[model samples]
Target chain A: MPIKSMYVTYSDSIYQFIYFLVGDDELAKDLTQETFLKAINSNPQFRGESSEKTWLSKIARNLVYDHFRRKRLLKFIPFLHEHEQIDYTYSPEQWLEAKNEQYELYEALGKLPHHYREAIVLRKIEQFSIKESAQILGWNEAKVKNATERGMKKMNELLGGERDA
Target chain B: MLDSKLRSLERKTLDEETKNSQLLKLNKRNKDYMKKQKFTYSVTLVLFGLLLFVFSQTITESPKSIQSQQLTNFELGEVTKAYYLYSKRADRMYNLTSPFYTDKIFTTDPAVLNEFELLFKNSEWLPFNGDLTKYTTSINYLFQLENGESVYLKEINEDGFFVNPNTMMQTKLAQQSHEQFVFYWMHIYMGKNEFPPWKIGLLTILLLIFVYAAIKSNKRGTIEKNSSLINLSGLGLAFFCIHKMNEWLGVNHLLTLLLIFTFFMSATVYLHILIKKQEPNWKYHIQRIFMANIVLFVLFI
Candidate 1:
């Protein structure tokens, strides 16, 4: 498929995956752009081992991991961004009933370890099959099953419910 | 709530305008990255070549010759003439020949030259018809007099050659001659006896600027290959400078070992930086490990 068509097809899924992985809209947008840019530049040889969605998700996941590595390194030198203020302006009044619940679910998702968060987001929210999630994560199917089960249990605890609905 | 909300969000997509703009930005960045890589590769090749030239010249040139010119071989004959003139020789000896001393001046001391002239007047210059295989630091010249036993001439520095009258006098004569050679090449170049504050300050400032630029460029998510290669060559040059300094200071074996260990530690860190920018494939892992070992081996040598 042409890159533009693929971007059109997959950009939302990719962005939402990154947004939940890291709880920031601007960062998710940046990483989404970076992910597509990497795909365009690398011209990866798609051997049909996984679907294009799985491939793009894998790229977006790697980009997010790279971003987190950089952030961890920056944390050592706090003085570098001393003047930059973090925005925390999301008021409860602005969020509708469903948006507020989704927001709380993501807040809990962001607290999970990267593997657990990725497994939960891919399986529960994105609703990818276990085999597909394993293909995207470059993991075996068994590991995906374990991470998803454990991740969903933890998410339930954090949300104070057995199920979201 | 989760399944319904996810279904509602699933319909969301970037608008056409935002998608087009992001594509445009990606294209621009890709072009810029390619241009930067081309520039970096060219600069790295040029800098590596220049460093190689400088390294070769440093090995060839005397440490003191940068500050003051040493007399050439043709001019060394002047010292011979001065020696004969001072000795008031009725007839100049034409057969006073040295094997490696053909053009290179052995000594500038008038007294030693006169003594050689006097010795030459009485004896025929038996050419040291021995092996003339020249080495970096010293040359051994062996000649036999017509009546006297053979004398071995060993030339070390510009003014530190010794004419041993016989095999028994070789060690003793060379020691005395070395003490009186009157040359301090190391002290002249490295300035161990004096410190130049301005030079040190200027060098430090330039180093700081180079490091700052490298760090800033690296943080922008582009690891220019040229900068890394330049750093690799710079590390080599640092190793060379430290070796020369060690020679100058008459450093002991233990200190040399310590300095070498520190250099290897730094080189390992630098190798890690070079490898970190590469793709994490099996080929990359093998290449990274291979290159690191090669770097450490080269530096150790």
Candidate 2:
């Protein structure tokens, strides 16, 4: 498919995926833009090895990892941490108005390690199948299943025993 | 269940206008990337062309001193002249055609002629400054050997050609007429004229500055993902080192060129992979490809 069509089809999912990974909306948008730019320039062939969404998710995941790496590097500076806070338009009031359970889940998700958070976001929130998540994460299906199970259990523990039915 | 709540939370998080605007921004970024890629490829091709041109020129003929026709056409009285030409059959030695002969003599051996042609193929006139005071008024036909040695064809005044010419003149002629002179002159010329130590030192300083800036910027996390300036500088340093190695080993012109071209092509491929796997930064990779080619041209040719 042409790059323009792919952008129209997958930009939101890619953006939302990045948003969940980084916990910042503007940065997510920037990374998503970078991801699609990389994809279009690479012009990867779709050989049906995995779905287009999985391929794009993999690219988006790698970009987020790069962002994390840069952040980790910058964390060494003492003053930089004081000045650098995650910038996003979402406010606590807006999250509460949307759904209290969802807001609590977002907070709980942010407390998880990157891998677990990614697993939960893809397998549960993004609704990717275990096999599809494995493809996107470059892992075997068993690993995806295990990570998702552990991630959900951790989320339950972090949310203070409120089981959202 | 938790899954249904997650599903409901994910739904309609972004409006149509936001998604469309995001796509528009992405489209602009892609266009910018393509433009950068196209520009890089063009620069690389141009550098390759320049390298090929210089490589061909270097091997075809060595640069010679420009000669004047005034001396060649002048007639001197009762002056016997002899042409010294290289002889390959005689173990690549200079054999003088008997001094009794007054006409010009040409050698049939290309290897022998090539050696002489490089040093004395062209000529220039220099004022006579030698101890021979009588010839001070006349101009000397000067041919500069690649090693910076000067050969002068001086006219005999009252005395015809001396019983034995100056040993320096004979040595100069013999050196120019030897096949070994080709390699010897090339080494001296390449070492002294092509790559001077001062120039290499300057390039080294420039490379260090580039590396330092890259490291500092990368550490601060202020570097843009698509920035290639550091990579281009690194490639330039690599080319300089390679060219220096070639000069030290005295590699043949054609082989040196082939090696440089191969190194550059491989580097280009590696950088291309980096660009594809990471951000779409084409400027530096392309600049590297182009700069390496141009450096090889300046170094070898």
Candidate 3:
């Protein structure tokens, strides 16, 4: 299909997925745009091995990792962090309040390690089938199932510990 | 309760304005990409046409196509003043027939003349259009007759074809002639030691692209930028390197392309590592420019 229609149909889902990964709404929106651009740029090699949605989700996921990698770079350049633009639009506190429910659980989810967050988001939030999640995450179905269970367990532990504090 | 909240969390999507705006941006980029693809296709087509025109087969003299003024190999006889005429410039082209061109190499030796004679025996010619020098590097084979008449056959150029003496027709020397003539010309021009025009143009383009990409990358101050200029040149080099390696190693082009692409990704990752370690700004900037040019040269060539 032509890219415009593809973008219209998938951009929202891609954006939503990135938002889950990064926990920043505005950044998610930007990443969604980047996902579609990458799709267009690499279109010639799209062998139709998977559904377009899965392919786009994978692209979105990769962009999120890229975003994290760049952010991680700031750890070495502490001074650079001062100059960094902090977008509070989707900070855990603000995002939890805006959503008006699941405050502790959502914050705990944000604190999960990247792999677990990825698994939980794809499996629960996006509601992709195990097979589809595996395809998008480039993981095996067993790994996806393991990650989701552990991720949920860890999330609850964090939620409980926070409440006790 | 946790599952329920999670379900609720999964439910949100981008607002309409954001989604629609993104779509518009994608459509614009898609349009530009289409235009670029078309332009690249045209360039590839023109290059292909030039190649076919250049190395085109010599026309075999046939009874039906013979003309009274048509110069055939048989009518051309033994000569005393045979010289291989060539000039780095095209304007000095036909002037070689008068020994007025700046560069001329004598090839009147019997063995070399025999090679030319045998190569052109019953030569086939085709009517051609355009000045060869504008598009290709070619040289003239001046078979100067003892009587002062000169038959100037353009030895096929780097593009693998050259011009007929009549200037109206183009001909391809046999592959053997092409090689032998090249062997002779290499002796004279190899010492000229100047970069070929195409090389100069390619280097200039690579430098410009590298500089432009570096400036843009620095201005953004974020490593997240994915300028098409960088991608285009990077991929260009990747494909070129793949092709060259394929020739050397006989590996698949696609496979080699993937390997080279991986190298690029690794370099980007390494850059991140460097940035994380807070490499000196000057060093970072210099490496950034160097990396950009390496990809550009690999990509552009």
**Winner by TM-score:** 2
Docking class of 3: incorrect
**Candidate 2 has which clashing residue pairs, if any?**
B66-B123, B67-B123
| Native contacts kept (model 3) | 0.41
Q: List the candidate numbers ranked by TM-score, top first.
A: 2, 3, 1
Question: Candidate 1 — what's its lDDT?
Answer: 0.50
Return the lDDT, model 2, position B280.
Answer: 35
Scanning candidate 2 chain A in windows of ten residues, the lowest lDDT window is A83-92
Candidate 2: true contacts recovered, fraction: 0.31
Model 1 chain B is weakest, by summed lDDT over 10 consecutive residues, at B83-92
lDDT of 2 by residue, B1-301 (tens): 6667667664324567767776787778777877877687778668878866665444333323334333322211121222321111111111222221111222234453344454433322233324543433321232334454433343334121211112212113333333353344344444444656777677767656666875664332223343476666666666665555443432354356566666776675666556544333455454455456545544653
Fnat by candidate, in order: 0.14, 0.31, 0.41
Maximum-lDDT candidate:
3
Docking class of 2: incorrect
Listed in order, the DockQ scores are 0.10, 0.22, 0.18
- Please give the distance, in angstroms, between residue B130's alpha carbon in candidate 2 and its true position after superposition: 32
Mind giving the per-residue lDDT tens digits that candidate 1 earns over B132-233?
233233533333333443333454343443322222122222344444322322222334334367645644554565567556533333322346654554
State the TM-score for model 1. 0.40
Better of 2 and 3 by TM-score: 2
Taking all chains together, each candidate's TM-score versus the true structure is 0.40, 0.46, 0.46
Off by over 4 Å in 3: A72-90, A93-100, A161-165, B57-301
Query: Which regions of candidate 1 are displaced past 4 Å?
Result: A1-13, A22-27, A34-116, A123-147, A154-165, B1-11, B58-126, B130-301
The order by descending lDDT is 3, 2, 1
